[model samples]
Structures are given as C-alpha cells and as structure tokens.
Target: MQGSTHGIPIDTDKSSPIIVDLIYRLKIRDVMTSTILSCRPEQTMQDAQKLMKDNSITGVPVMVERRLVGIVSMDDVINALMTGTMGQPIEKHMSRQVIVLEDDMPLSFGISWLDKYRYGRFPVLNAKKELVGIITSRDIIVTLLLEMNKEIERFEEATSHREASTSGFHLEYTTRRFDFEMAGRLSTETKRQLKERDLPPKIIRRVAVAAYELEMNQVVHSAGGTVRVVYDGNQGRVEILAQDTGPGIPDVESALSEGFSTATEWVRSLGFGAGMGLPNTQRVSDAFSIESSPAGTCVKVTIATEERSNP
Candidate 1:
C-alpha cells in the first residue's frame, strides 16, 4: 500500500497485514525472553558450543564485565571446529560487529532489521547498552498471534453490544505542530473507537494506517491540523478527514509517487519522511481525494467495513 504524509510517501511491505499491525505496536521488551543465557568473551569456544548444544540454542551473546561485546553463533562454532580453534577464546571467533535491539524499540524495527540480516535471533540491550535479553523470529510470531487473539476477543465483546441500526460514530482530534511525541495518538484513538464498534480487523488496519500517516503529516509538516473519523454503519464504511493549515503541497502528483519526498535531512534522519505515506493511504482506502492550496491541505479517505472476496 502507499500514502503520503506531507510530501513524503509511505509504503507497506508485503508481509501479513495482521502481523504488521501487531508488531508495529509491540515493544521488544514485551516479547523478548529476558532470562537469557550468555557467554563471556574469555570463555572457550568449546564451552560456548557446549552451552548452546545443552540449551538447544544456536547462538549466544558474548559479554565482557556484564556489557555486550559480540555474539557467537552455531556457524561460528562450526568454523572454529573445522579450523581447530575450539580451544581458543570465544572472543577470537565471535562476531565483533553486533547488531542489537533496544529494550524499548518497537517490534516493527526489529522485524525490519531481522529481514535485512536474516538473523535467527538478536541480542536485546537496555538503556545502558547492557545485554538484557534475546529475541527470535519465533518469539515475534508467537507474540503477534497472542495479540491477534486478544483483538478477536475484543471484537466479540464489542459485537455483543452492537446496536441494530448502523448509525455509526464520529470523533475528532486536534494535531499540534512539531509534536513528534504524539504523532500517532489520533490514529491510535481512532483504532480504539473502531474496535469498540466491532469493525473487522482488515478495516481497522486500513483506517489505522491512513489515520497515522495523516497525523504524522500534520505534526511533521503542518502548523497544526484536525483529524476526524466518521463511520456510517448503514453504509458499512469509515471515512477519515485530515485538514492541515500548513503550506500546501505544491505538486500533488509528485507527492503521490513513491520515493518522492520534500522532507528535510533532519526529518529523514528521524525516519519520518520517505515519501510513502499518502500513496499507502490511497492504496488501503477504497476511495481517496485531496485538495491543496497555499492556505492549507485537506485529505479524505474512505474504507469499506468488510473484506471483499475475489470473484
């Protein structure tokens, strides 16, 4: 899917949509196994391998004085054995350049890194850069599954209170300038409201993405804005309206294209502007329209309440 926040477009990956939602909200500490088994750099390669074998694990973090220094995996062990270096210190053969996750980082960040490196597991570090735990892809999958179950339960509960009429609901939120701290707050609230109304998971996911992208746009590029969500139960649809008083997008066509961005270097550094936001919003919404001028920009997105099957 594609969408633009400001002039930057957003793109969604081809992974499972439900899984993406789950991972995007979860922090590493929420899913990581804190009771980690690690090895010291001074430990013999033989000892590290034995520990891994005994625990049925394939990798272990190498530490020095309680701080992470490197990592040793089964591949390292095999190479050591072949080269007759099993007797050497693990530090000698361990991967010195380690890629670690912070405990508070979102699972989505970890997922991206994992996809890039195809690592079996990652060492998780705390604010002090000390190894605190470890996480594997299996852990992420299991956690997401559990979260999905909770969402299902919430849906059931919400549906139990469903009204006979499809009158639906409406909500409005104000966005602030340079409010990076609360960029996605409006979107999160919108998702909560949709869940309370027992909207389908697919619908909720799309609305959430669009709302978030718009919210980010207001915070990152606009002076301020308002996000409004209007759901029509009778029509089985939800519409999102985002209006901002920022300098309007000069080139709407260019803004919709993938990889097109007008964000400053600082915004790019913070990972906010990659030019995929509006395109992603358009991709997920059943209908999308926008109007822009020097005065302001307004975006409207509509999504169906139910998934449509392929003919």
Candidate 2:
C-alpha cells in the first residue's frame, strides 16, 4: 500500500499508465460472447471434455436449469484424467465457486477480475443471475485496442481544425456517473497534446497520471462533473480542474488517508477508490488544492512542464 516511484511516495493508488490505454467506455455485455458453449452439471467429465474439444474452448459454464452452477476448464479435465475420474459427474470436478461477471458491469471489472484471478475466461450472468455469455481476456484486449484506435482517430480529427503552434489550449470534458466506457479518453487526449508540445517525459507522465486519476474519480464517484485542462506555455505548466456535483467528501483529511475508502463494492470491483486519487495527484503536482461539501467537490492540480531535479 506504500511504495515509492523514482523516490516519490505512492500510497494505496494502483493507477497505471498502461491503465489509460486499457480504460474504455465499454460494458461487459458489449464485448461478451453471447452465444456461450456450456454444459450441465449432471454431465460426465468425459462429456464436458468432449464439448470443450468440439468447441475448441478451454472452459465451459455449467448450468443447471438456467442457473450458473460452476465452470469446468481444461485443467479440471486434466486433473480428472489423472485421477481416473473422467467418467464422474462434472459437478464433482468443476469449480463451484465461480467468479462471474454481470452484464451491466464495466469492462474494467472484467479486466481487473482476470488480472486478479488469472482466469482464462469468465462466465457472464445477467441481472437475474442467469448465464448469458462468456468473455475472455483476448476479447478485452481486442476491444480495447479497437477503442484506443478510435480515440486516436477522434483526437486527430478534433485537433485538425486547431492551429498547430497555438501558445496554449484549454479544453473541458464532461463526465457522468458510472461512465466507464469514456473514462480515460480525455486524459489520453491530454497526454497526446503534451507529447506534441514536447514536454519533458516526467512532466507528461505526471500529467497523464493526474488526468487519469481525476477522470476516473469523477466517473466513478461523482454524479456528474466537468474536467478542465489549461496548458500555459508562458508559465510552462498544465492546470487540471475537476468539479463534481455529487455528494461531496465529508472529511477531506480522512479521504486523503492511505487505504481509506468509502466506495461501494461495485465501484471497488472496477478498480477505483483505494484512497489514492487525491494523494497521488498531490504527490505528482507542483501545486494542489481541494474543496468539498454536500453539494459538490472541486480539485485542482498543476504540474510544471519543467521537471524538478531530485534533491
């Protein structure tokens, strides 16, 4: 929960630069394979293995009367084969405590679940807890790559009308509650702009991390918010402001505490609210300020284009 990056203390934050690339405004149902190949719990292990081989899939969801019961994978088959239990009922060999994904959940939840559990695939269920589809890490990778390319195309189109050598640029983006699909697009664009300006890598990195964390915090925690970025060539600094009209933080001091979180389980599932946003932003910024009340919250983070040499 406590670590240092290039000697800068990192709290319970787990936001990664690579996360900006993976974050998309997508839901699990958007990418899940709706036509699932599955078996029944009463089926024999040999039968399940044959189904897996016929479909060329490593795993299959086990359903019993439209309810998800378990999942059987190639590893289970191999174990059964070794133990001479191939003819046994699949329910006896399959993993009963299956980690499943819901249809409406964000793609980030799937990404986090796979990364945390190292599962080859997950059985997706609907609101009624019925097996609806299946998704694999490959699906997530392909979808994210496509989304990233689309974002790049959009960024190019948006910037095409602007003067290339403009002294400064100011932009604002709106974020909505649970808007996971569009979470990191603005930050990615900001990073692109910084790269075009040829800012120092350290500065760009700090801005990228700050922008991503702020964007995600708004998307996950706020009712709705506006993220504004102002780059000043004269001052050699980029300023980011996030203002949200959500239920504001009651205790700013406690919210900044490492590992402190009031996020719901659903939010935590998508990998936010480990109590790192404000602290991480402050750590990377040249200046930071925050204000909150029941009506709303506003956070301002400023990073200089010039990197500060390590003392």
Q: Top model by lDDT, which number?
A: 1
Tens digit per residue, CA lDDT, model 1, 88-183: 999999999888999998777767777777788999999998888999988888887789977875775466336323457776778898778767
RMSD in order of candidates: 16.5, 16.9
lDDT of 2 by residue, 13-50 (tens): 46554444244348899888899888898899999999
> How many pairs collide in each candidate, listed in order?
18, 4
- In order of appearance, the predictions have TM-scores of 0.47, 0.53
- After aligning candidate 2 to the native by TM-score, how far in Å is the CA of 105 from where it should be? 34
Model 1 poorest ten-residue lDDT run? 1-10
User: Which stretches of candidate 1 lie above 4 Å from their native place?
Assistant: 1-21, 160-311
